[model samples]
Target: MTKQEFLRRYKDENLTIGAEYMMILDKISDAPLVLGCAYDQGVWKIYKTGERDGHYIIKEYASENEAFDFFYELVLSKHNRRNN
Candidate 1:
């Protein structure tokens, strides 16, 4: 999914994108998790920042669509777990 699509789908979830539009964050948790993308040399790198082991990248993706899909599923899982 594109960033705009993700935003539209989760408009009520209060998600935030970084100033450079390189990352999206979920701030509902105390330790906000993030899905970020960066251009490293000639490659587009998509990664997730997690607190599980001292705020590091827990996963990486080669494409924005894949990254966004995982991010979307992650948010849904977190919401479901919290609500249950």
Candidate 2:
């Protein structure tokens, strides 16, 4: 889906525009790729890449929906597009 569409659909949920983030993953030749988001006291979160058993998660600094959207789009959408 387009970014605008995503924003519209999740607007009531308090989505934000132009979120910022950095991603870290295992760089070994055959290591599993994970998505990480730095939020809430600067903790590193690992997201499963579906090659293994794990959950798709959202890490946000604030309890509000906008904060969640910022982290989710910044970390999730970017990685997904690249991997695809």
Query: Backbone clashes per model, in order?
Result: 0, 0
lDDT (tens digit, per residue) of candidate 1 on 1-84: 865666677677754343322343432122334555443444334455555532344456676677567767765665566556
Q: Please provide, for model 2 over 4-84, each residue's C-alpha lDDT reduced to its tens digit, 9 standing for 90 to 100.
A: 443455555553322332233222111234444323344333343334544455443433344435545664466566556
Best by TM-score: 1
For candidate 2, give the lDDT of residue 10.
Answer: 50
- lDDT score at residue 20, model 2, on the 0-100 scale: 37
How many clashes would you count in candidate 2?
Answer: 0
Q: Which stretches of candidate 1 lie over 4 Å from their true place?
A: 12-54
lDDT of 1: 0.52
